[model samples]
Target: MTSHSAPKLAWTYENRLLLILFMTFGFVFFDRLALSFLFPLMSAELHLTNAQLGMVSSALSLTWALSGAATGAWSDARGTRKPLLIAAVLGFSICSALSGLVAGFVSLIAFRALMGIAEGPVLPLSQSLMVESSTPSRRGMNMGLLQGSAAGLLGAMIGPPVVIGMATAYGWREAFYVSCIPGLLIAFCIWRWVREVPPGGVRHAQAEGAATQAAGGTTVSRWALLKERNILLCVLISCCFLTWFVVIISFAPVFLVENRHLSPSGMGVVMTCLGAAWVLWGFAVPAISDRIGRKPTMIAFALIAAVCPIVLIHGDSVWALGTLVFVTYTGLGCFTLFMATIPAETVRPRAIAGALGLIMGAGELMGGFVAPTVAGFAADKYGLQFAMWMSAVGAILACVLSFALVETAPAVLRRRALACAAARLDTQNVGGR
Candidate 1:
């Protein structure tokens, strides 16, 4: 009997890469957000205050911002992704496991900050890789999928229950320990499956060629690249969006339980709606934007998100609150659009990671680090419900900023350019006739 080799499946390298990165990003969110679910328990055990909790969370963001900027530049210069990604996963996983061993606020902050240093590069770097891998037409959709997995599936939906349940049954410490396992597993998968693209390589060459053609062979320096109007707008928009995100994630659970009188389990249920909305809109909005335009989709969603906190303050029932949460997240799909896709499309391919890093760092500094601290202080002094207005204000600002964005959708730009060319041809032909 002749032995035949089995037929290769349809799963391409891109498919495997996406699957691994998806899981990796999911674990990143899962690990980071596990703290949110455990906040009540941790605050109780450690005798911490709201301000202290915000400070601890802010520590992570501060370091993450600094490190992300540095590492993103480093990644761009180095032009290799696999080794850095593997190292990041390992570092974060170890720190996550150690978080379970912390005894006080100081130790907790230290550990989380360390984890942040490791994690800072993951998002921008992974995004850079994914952008290089995807065709231009599908770029928004691909990025949305990655962000959705992190924010919706793993972070919001599954993370709360699993982490909270573990904290309830075993201990919050055990939950931390368990969360690290996935990171380690994913690190191995990345090492085995992912390939690196170096600087001045095929993707970089293509991007340079495109840039040369577009600019009539004039090359822009990296410094000049940073001065572009779109880059500045992207940074501001990111800050606004992140302010909304950090406030909601940091204090919403407490507000639900204490202000609205929902139980922990009930808060989890409401939070699940956040995940579902993120998944639904994260995929749908970006996909739609591919057809329509990023600016309109962003403006519409941001307006919808801006109203959620106002309605939520008045919402008395779980259904009402959940629906509002869903609406809020639908707007947040623009987060992926603004931070990853827009900045990527705006810059030369070689500068993608660095530009993303700058955008992420700026957002994290203002939104992630400062916003939560201010909100926590407000919650302590005024009320948790009042603190939610901060997010509402940020959302409104983001909606306004959406209008300033240059339409960067490749398909849309191509269609418009073609239409203009066709119209010019028609005019010339009529004049000849």
Candidate 2:
């Protein structure tokens, strides 16, 4: 009998997990953005003031920030991501569906806040899982797809067009109703397939929890994370970047529709352009960072990001506007770099979830909660265009702050270390001779 070696399957656990998380995080954004897309249509009928709309926008952000911080630490300590992951996906989807039933501002924000509670930990937890599964070389790309492109593609690219079409035909409420279905299905998939991974990748879930417990990932305090310079810089960047992103997405659709005098369809077209840009630049930036270094990638992309809102405000034709939107919307790619990549590289594996949660929470608190409310008041008092300017300022601030971020990409650091080692070897050999 001849013994034959079996060919290996190319589709590994890493690929499978990435695909699942890509969908899971993507749907989270899709449901979150549904309200923003439907706002222009519902604002008048629901009698929402600009400030109220801003608050409504911030509502989910507030709760999400708090929930994410708590749950991220909880997951790290417990070393159980699947149950919390399943619960968040299921809870948020149901809450998003309930938004369709709200007739007034109070109920709308209430539902949004509840949705935030459920959606808060999805990103950090998903990232923790991905980091565990990903090869060192592919960490930036994998996490970028998970954090940036997934949201951009589903929430921004596909979401605006679909929501607008539904709102146009069936009315805005129906769009919300339909958005809930995807998250529910994603939750079931996660429950069935997703499992915990040990810090060093040697142990399975059964052993991981105990190993993780001994390593002290569970007992680390949130305040202690602030001791690291990279974490501090990331948190600050999150504040400014979130201000730019949240304020624009929250107000730009309305700005395009009312301030630019765009028809709903025209607004949808422009929004879709932004989404497409988001999808392209989102993953590309982080992948580039993997090679070039995270700091330069952020500085360059944020410079372009600062220009996006300006072009939207100034460009007259849809062709001109759409082209600029795609070109300047490069900041989404930087999100994963600072939010998850930088933190993951800086902190110990056990505390990664906590670090991710803190960065997100701080950003949400300021950028998500505070910025939108202020911009809304500015919109009402000055004009909607003011909101766009605010977005630009946020990007500019992030660009300046990027100067301070320590280089953390593994490939970059590895190459530098190799060069130093080679130089040391040459000097030692020469001295001996």
Candidate 3:
């Protein structure tokens, strides 16, 4: 009998886990961003105002912010991530499908609010799981790719045209319905493949295991988590990132078509390049940063992101525009990598999910609420070009603020210790004990 070597699996169980993570994120990107591509079609059919449209978008963000804390806390207490992930997916998918059915602004906004409520918990829970699942040796690479796939790469780029085509063929509602199919599939996959690990370390799959005790219920309060200055600083830094992120993603296509005189196809291509650049950074940079340390890379990215907008606003050529897009996406991608590291550095084992909920919810609210509407008003009063340029200025502010954040790398432990000390002193004095 001839013995044959066992067929080597192309992807180990671990690699398959990464693929599942990527797919989950891909659905999120598609669901969230497809709205922007469908916006024009919806506007034309419903004859909506910019404010009304912005309101609809804002509704989702607002609910996300509102519900995030509760959702995160609940997930942490339950010690299971699958429930939250599955619920978020189903809620968003159902609401997204319902969004297609709405005939008026009021109905659409209500459904969006429902979607936001569901959408809120996903990031913190998913990410906490991803990081825990990863070997510390490769955490940054895993994180960077996760952010890149979901935020920068396929979600924003490929989604636009797909949504656009569906809208063109069937109507805006049909487009949303089509988008819903993929998310449902993804939710099922996550249910089957993804397992929730405890935040502090590895945990048990059954009731009476060592891992279970290792991940036992956290005693930390939400108030205590917020009191950590490093965490707060991270949140403050994220505000800037969120502002720029929302402004660009929400308004870029509109600006390209209205201000730059690009055809829909042309605008789509520009956005595609921009999205692709982000993906490249997500895939390439964070992994490298894991080796070099998160702080130096974050600071460098912030500084560069600050400059990218200025270049993007003034450039006229297609090549120049493409170059600017790449630069901007790179900076944005770096900011994302920075954001992912905060919980790893700040939150204790038990409270990671809650911390993430607070951070993401707050950032999403500010970004969705203040940035885009202000940009829209600016576009109405001044021009789309000016609005975009102004948003870039906001990005620069975010960069400047990011300088204050303690680096997430292990080398920055001294700084973190110092910050914690200063924070403790401030609190002690403030308490008047």
Candidate 4:
């Protein structure tokens, strides 16, 4: 029998960019999850409490929120994807490696915080990098494949088995060290391959302004972007999305292992199934929704997510929960679509990266920072069920918000482009002698 390859250009610039994004995101998840795996080891060694553990989890988000927007702005002003990509990868990996060496909780938090700072810019910058490279028509498909397939599904699947095996054999610290190595290699790949998008070109407002002024038309300030309505909605959506995402991802595995009494290998298998389903849906659903409309897609997914809690809480066996998780993630895949497509539609071309950074950073703060600690605390006190239940509230809110979201398609962009052109021509005629 002969072997056949998958589509070749599914392995094109779009695919490569998606792969890089996935690797960066996967490393971050692996790094963050290390703390959870290490907690048993670190806590016994240092005599840490639940409260202390919460703080350590919180530390990642605290640093991320503090630096996220600034990093986005820097990317916007500089338009240098490779530098941002390289710095985030190196910083996070180094800090994550150093975390294994920490002797106390305070030092651990500090190192994890540093890791947060390093990793904070990667998500927004990755989105920005993709938006710049792809057209609006394909943006949903591209982002869905990159984030949903590479980062979301692939990372979740790969991280567990690797983390579990390494932690079991060599101890958790060794796992952290092991996980950091892949990122270092990825940093090299990003530096070598990810092209630098030069600053001040066709995408910049100032560049457009200069061209418009030379043609006797008024120039728009980048600052004017702050006044847009959809921008505000994007921020709100990000906050809700992050809150829900964190509520689930941070604690679900812990629930499956501790409360459900599954072995680590069993837990890994279930998660791998769930993760594969999610990545597959992430690739598939967004492509379908792109043809239908983002609004309808979001609403449908949000509603599906709303049902996931019921199945998880009521399920009688591990197979039930595992099956439900897979179904739930199909809906969860909508998140990547929303995150990617909304900004490309809502924000001005020049300000997209910076705007996306602000939204993503804020979302991460809510989702990654606050949600995890709260979920951890709740899981400790009221049981994991409460934490899982709270996710229902978030899914409902996301569904409601989806109903209110703007529909951005090619037609919308064409109309807006035509209007801008007409307004420019009108202004130019008035200024002509």
Best by TM-score: 2
Query: Model 1: per-residue lDDT, tens digit, 1-433?
Result: 1122211221255556677887888788788878877888888888878887788778888888898888888777656667888999999999989999999989999999999999888988888888887767678888888876456788888888888888889998998988888888899898877877522226683467566768786434446656877788878887888888778778877788888898888888888888788778877888888989888888998888777677667887998889877876676588788888888888878778888888889989999999888888878999887668998898889989889889988888999999999999999999999
- Candidate 1: give its CA RMSD in angstroms: 4.3
TM-score of each: 0.92, 0.94, 0.85, 0.83
Better of 1 and 3 by lDDT: 1
* lDDT tens digits, residue span 325-410, model 2: 98999989989998999999998777889899999999999999999999999899999999999999999999999999999988
Task: Summing lDDT over every window of 10 consecutive residues in candidate 3, give the lowest-scoring window.
Answer: 1-10
Supply the TM-score for candidate 2: 0.94
Question: Residue pairs in steric clash, candidate 3?
Answer: 204-211
Per-residue lDDT tens digits for candidate 3, residues 296-411, read 67667766666655655666965677677776676655654655665666666567777777777777777766766777776677766655666566666666665666556654
Report how far residue 172 has shifted in candidate 2, in Å: 0.8
Model 2 off-target regions past 4 Å? 1-11, 198-200, 203-218, 429-433
* Sequence-dependent TM-score of model 3: 0.85
Tens digits of per-residue lDDT for model 4 on 1-433? 1123222332365557767776777677667666764565466788876556766777787788667777877766655567877988998889988987888878988998998899888877887777766655777887777667765454676666777778888987777776678889989989877755422214454464466668986422335544665566666666777766666665566666667777767777776766677677777777877777778788888777766656666766777777877787665467665666676777666566677667777777776678777877877788888767877777777788778777786655567689999999999999995
What CA root-mean-square deviation does each model show from the true structure?
4.3, 2.8, 7.7, 7.4
Off by over 4 Å in 1: 1-11, 198-223
On the 0 to 100 scale, the lDDT of residue 305 in model 2 is 96
